[model samples]
Target: MKKSLIVSFILSAFLVTTLSGCGSTSTAVSGSTDTKVPATAKTEKSTTLRIGYQKYGTVNFLKANGELDKVLKEKGITIQWTEFPGGPQLLEAMNVGSIDVGHTGEAPPIFAQAAGTPLVYLGHEPASPASEAILIPEKSEIKSVAELKGKKVALNKGSNVHYLLVKQLEKAGLKYEDIQVVFLPPADARAAFEKGSVDAWVIWDPFFSAAETSAKAKILADGKDTVANHEFYLATRSYAQSNPETVKTLLEQLAKVDTWSKDHPKELSETLSPQLGIDVPSLERAAKRRTYGIQPIDDALLSEQQKIADSFFKLGLIPKEINVKDAVLPATK
Candidate 1:
């Protein structure tokens, strides 16, 4: 009799909830949390938020003129966008408090945090090792990673490729000091690699793809096992915590653009090509290889990121080990 009474009560509650949820237009957070908003109700505004982004990373026109801006605009907030060449520079800007939010890859944030940069990882993206690599001239004599010893390799120092080259050398049983590291920007490195000044170029796509097709560069090795090459959305801890409401809407919009980009790769390239001034073909090539979804800052992801920083320390690229979770916002987990 007691079991039957409990079952009856449960069924009654389910029936009530089922009927109450009929034709719902807004997502209800909980039984008591109000989610319904009148059409005339304006979303309350919040603090000023500045977002930074690089040309080749996730922050293209997606933040500049797309739905993210529109989403935030709807909430009566304003966003200021600052552009960067690479993650290292962007982190530099962040460390100096030039901006509050930006997107970068795994390695730069690791290096930046090691050097006492104050950026925090808010979230991440799906891992894709193919996004970064080491490219050589197609007909070059360097057939194996071992042959890179004493060879001039051009790379952006302290960027994602910095750790990649270290791991590549270690895989070949070579010490980090065995190779001549030529630190160069992407543009200068392309020129130097083309002029035969460097034996190989360690770079990320669409530069890697361009080097393969137009520059006739061969990929000697890629991020395989060395990295997952996951893109990270970082922000100032103070900024993210103080402006949760603004950040929440902005992240949702980012996820929205990511979903749309996945379904419409060609559309994404067509939209970004003109802004980047890099032709549709190159943009399309990049879009094909990249995975565009933001990830919550789960423990597993943080563990992997910590390993990345630890590896840099083991290889002597960094003087001391950094607790990656410390740099991560407290609300990160």
Candidate 2:
């Protein structure tokens, strides 16, 4: 009987030790604060950056050369490129979560912000005022901006050219209401301009150069003395805040390309010609007048953007007044 009791006692001791070890493990896993994993550590990082680009710009150039991909690949980030007809369409895609980063002109962001799209300015290119212009037919009777009064003018609405058209009209003593504005993308506007459907078409290069060279369009007025045609780089507010290093890498790559492009106009044009489906000469003409450099957002630049926002608000182009500074990227620590 004692032998049997001793065996029972040994079995009880074995179960107690096992149960105690299990309890300790359970406490460590479920109850211990020091053993808990951080919320950030549990989150996964993004692996792809979706970019939106127009037919012509530094972004397009970057895509054409395929250099950005190589640079980003080192960091395990891949790129997805989407071609947009113009700035408005690109920002629209951004609003719908179709794209993460994009390039646009001065005016689209203003309209987008007024409509409450969550975008943050990443950087800007120097003002290339001569890059965009108001064009008439080779033989059109309209000689100047004032003559465009009461005539139908074609343009991509909310594009950089929109502000150009507005400022040019103001300078020529014509109100915004004085002209009939036809809203169309670059391709459609080009067709309308060709078929005499519109008297004037306001556009940016290399479309402007194409119109001048192939379609024989004449310059009615450019943004030279009117508006600062600054091109901006932007990203969705969420993407920018989450992936700042990727954004920085992109800007650095763009800067390198811009520097090379400025010094090698002929090569740059030739490189972009096949991709754009524009002739080399036309691309060259566009490249010649382009100012190449990317700059950070500053108070002076923001002030200029604010003037555009105010002008657009006064003209009822945007629904409500917006502060341009609110769209700027938060300063880094």
Candidate 3:
């Protein structure tokens, strides 16, 4: 199936899988939605903790360290890691109960919430505004954001770059309808952009880094100048509420890995090069574009997430308004 068609099907089925026997909601003490794990579930002591992660990012770093395996093994729990192409797909797996915890860019959670997926915000990475970009071919005559008007632009629908593209267009005094958006995932979009099938492509690293070097693409704008591009960690409502200690342990391990990643980018890149199948320098370059820190969900973070929810709703991209605060896990003491 075409990528777009597959994405559409996933989006359409999102609520169906989430609401139909997959999840149940309880009223929390704070009046938030507390989604409980499905009943025919194994105990925390009996089952493996399934974590879905994108091919790059923190989970890859965590997997490389191998500490998570040793730690979980002590608790009679094993780790099962699933790789996803991006956040949207990762969250789809979560909604279907295929994975218990995952990480994604800021936008996916908002889309998931709007689709009625029972998810909780577990944590987030500090904003790394330069990690994503809007690129025009090196020789393209379209120079400024305004020039994108009436042109075909390629990007993954509902991805982080989708929010970036929307905000950038508004900043350029263009309406959502002003440009032609061709919704394609990164690989296909890169192909379209290189062949001049799409005039511009909005994407995130390490794909953004790879394209900049391999395709010699020139950046028209980057997230640094436009949006607060924060990546988030999430869990199915049931999993987080039932496994608080496991969640805390996961966060602790992630923090150590993130701190180490910052201090050893070259070494980190060399280690990840084989796993990601990218050259060291490109991975190192991608490393330079990110900020590595994890933070708990808070009001300030929810405010930023609210902005994303509102933007999509305004654009008619999401079906309804989303209250980001309601989906956040209660503060851990």
Candidate 4:
């Protein structure tokens, strides 16, 4: 009987030790799970940021200076800068996921929106009215915006300068059908203008300034009294929505570079001239014409953007109407 009791006690002791060990392990696991992980610690670090830039903008300036790379390096973010001839092409790249963010004039995003591209407007450069203009050969007989009627005018269709041409025509009391519109990109338009194939060229700088300096082009009218010429920064909707922090960092860097560029136009021109293959003087003039104040898209800006969209739709530039506010990125999200 004692032997039987001793065996039973040994079995009980083994069971108790095993159960206690399991309970201790369970407690440890629960404690580990209960510990909070920091949001920053949990976030997956973004390694590369793909940026689409024009030859003449804050993004280009940042690329030229390597400032953005320096700013983002500590966060494990590296910049991949891609140059687009124009905003329309840049936004197209964004739609295809080739680029994560882009800098463009106001109109390309409108056209992109109409085309069902999922893009969001994150921010805007301040009004730069003097930077874009409709130019005539210095010796040409055409004197005013009214004279553009019945004359062939060249501009990149759906470009910001397109809006300037429309607004200038309206201000001159001319209908859209009154003029012979020639759709051409800046390079082709410059070629046509220089070769006297096109009577007038509506363009934006550094092309505008380059034409003035190199081609001896005369300004019929610039955006000063016409368009606000608000440059926009855009991102793919998926990227903007999913990676708000990354977008914010990009905007902040852009703003910093803009501020620096505005204050140091000479330095900026010197730095960018070789990179852009444009002369320093023209670049200096172009740089001076731009405003460095990058602002958040707000009600007043949206109202202006809406007018642009509605005008384009009515003029048959776009297939359908769109709400500018629909593409605005929420300040937080």
Candidate 5:
């Protein structure tokens, strides 16, 4: 009996020890009170500024120069570039958080604002009214914007050219409905223009220059006496609000590039030719038509933007009216 009692006591002691060890391990894993994290376990979040750009513009020039990247790197901000087919597409990317900063023509931002995209205008290039135009084939009989009545017109909807078309029609004393509008992107529009599928194609350079050179398109009317055709630099509202200094740095760099580009049209064309896959002659023509010099958004520009918005809303292009000033970058104190 005593031997059996001793064996029972030994077994009980072993059970207690094993159970206690398991309880301790369980507490350590699931119920520990320690709150300190190790130095190696901590990580600093990295910041990357995503920039959206189209094929031909100041942004493209900026990207090709590599100067902006070097400047940004010194400030611990890395740049990620995404190329979009046009301004509308670039702003669409901005609306979806794919890009933080981008450049676009005047009309895309109006549509974006109406659709509730949180975008703000950071700056604008001087109005290059002659840069965009309504072009007809060289062999075509169309002589004036007034002659476009009941004819088929092709343009990229919601582009800067859209407003130009509207204003041109109004100037010709023709209703917007008078012309049968065909919406197509630059490549398709160029194809249509070549195949005689479109009566006239409203476009901007370097496509304008390309069409003139290769497709034998002639300018019917340009924005010279009509629209401002301002090229705008834009950013997500959150980004501009949070990174004001970065935005300022970008505009400053663009200003410097603009000054350089104005004096070196030949060099600009040569530099952009290989990158754009366009001939130097065509690019040179485009460079001449283009105006450079970045300017801050001001009351006068806002009034012009508001006019565009009002016109679009009146024409039922955008669903709702939007205040242009609402999308301007908040003035820094």
Candidate 6:
């Protein structure tokens, strides 16, 4: 419930109605044209591939460039992108079956799996720890994590920064309840921080970058000492299984995009800055922290993620224990 807590428990037993269920989900493949369909149907139908993206990520760039849509269009596919403020909400849309493919941080899917929402991760983005962090007002006296006790912090529930907050508190030997959590979306949190409504904010870039530039926030802690919190490309179990072709296409195109972003970060950032209405320097700072590459799922990453989930459970944050590896798709060799 509290994003800035030492452990994450986002509706572990509730929101079971969603499709993030990794344990057992859909078996249908992508294109199921019926032999039962009146063999003489007149016009062919195009698949409306609904994708969800968060701001300042691969999906947003794809949408801004219109390249994914263009490439998929050749296959008679229609791309419909829905932008979310952060991962938790993006995964929420995916769970309800409205979004065919979505991207989110490491924590949301783990939380979703704990709740039995039907989702299977196809793969992960290159690891990037710098994208998320905890910030305090520049004028504040919060010199260390220990000072956070009894203070209020703002963060988006179930996002990657939520996990960062948890790990930081644990390192400080503090429980989540030691501080008050002000759960807020990025936009509202920004406004509140400017007005001093909350004591600190746990967030991701470009918001983190934005706050540094526009609001002069100071970094209290970051993902560097915690987890890499890789971005994941995921879909309903049924969707990935059914539309392997679509997923494959998406993967290849995404790999290319990731490569381009990595090789030409400065150019890319300069191009993307104003398009997103973020300051150019802010985008540059956020870009340097990103590492873009594709990797097959490995046991090491799964083990690390398990620790995160188990920590949440051990802290009484979640009602059910989660098996992190059970949800990971087999490594694509």
Model 3 lDDT per residue over 1-333, tens place: 443343333222322323332334433333444545457633343257899988678878998889999998998889999988888888888888899999899899999888888888766778999999999998999989999999999998888889999989989999989999999977899899999999999999888888888889999999876799988878887676566567667877887898899889999999988887777887889898899877655568788889889989988999999889878643320
Off by over 4 Å in 4: 1-46, 331-333
In model 4, the clashing pairs are none
Of the two candidates 4 and 5, the one with more favorable lDDT, higher being better, is 5
Where does candidate 5 clash, by residue pair? none
> If scored against the real structure, what TM-score would every candidate get?
0.83, 0.86, 0.86, 0.84, 0.85, 0.84
lDDT of 5: 0.80
On a 0 to 100 scale, what is the lDDT of residue 51 in model 6?
92
Local lDDT at 228 for model 4? 94
Candidate 5 regions off by >4 Å? 1-46
lDDT computed for candidate 3: 0.80
Model 2 lDDT vs. the true structure?
A: 0.82
Q: How many clashing residue pairs, candidate 2? A: 0
Residues 269-329 of candidate 4: C-alpha lDDT, one tens digit per residue: 9998888889999999999888876665567888998999999999999999898876753
Residues 1-333, model 1: lDDT tens digits: 343343333233323322232323233222344343234422333456788888776666376446777667777777788887788988889898898889888889998898887666666778878878898987799999899999999998788888788888888999888999999988889999999999999998777777776877888999878778888888765565455556666666666677777778788778777777666777778788888766666578889889888888997888899998777432333
As for model 3, its CA RMSD to the true structure in angstroms is 8.8
Residue 32's lDDT within candidate 3 is 46
Model 3: ten consecutive residues of lowest lDDT: 12-21
Q: Tell me how far the alpha carbon of residue 46 in candidate 1 is from the true structure, in angstroms, after superposition.
A: 6.2
Show pairs that collide, candidate 2.
Answer: none
Error of 1 at 21 (Å): 33
Q: Model 6, 1-333: lDDT tens per residue? A: 222120111111111212222223322122232112122322222377889998887766667667778888999888888889988888888777788788888888877887776777666765688778889999999899989999989998878888899989989999999999899999999988889989999999889998998899999988885878788777775565455556666766676676677777688778888778898888878877877665544567677778878877887766789887666433220
Candidate 6: TM-score?
Answer: 0.84
- Backbone atom clashes (below 3 Å) for every candidate: 0, 0, 1, 0, 0, 11
Candidate with better TM-score, 1 vs 2? 2
Candidate order by decreasing TM-score? 3, 2, 5, 4, 6, 1
Per-residue lDDT tens digits of candidate 2, residues 1-333?
A: 343343333233323322322222212222233232213321234689999999999999899889999989999999999999999999999999899999999999999999888888877888999999999999999887898889999999999999999899999999999999999999999999999999999999999999999999999889897888998999886676556567767877787788788888899899988888999999999999988777766679899999999999999999999999778533410
Of 5 and 6, the candidate ahead on TM-score is 5
Candidate 5 per-residue lDDT, tens place, 1-333, comes to 343343333233323322322222211122333222223321222368899998788888898888999998999999999998788888889888899899999999999999888887777788999899999999999999999999999998899999999999999999999999999988899899899998999999899998888877899999998999999988876666456556667876777687778888899889988988888888889888889877656678899999999999999999999889777533410
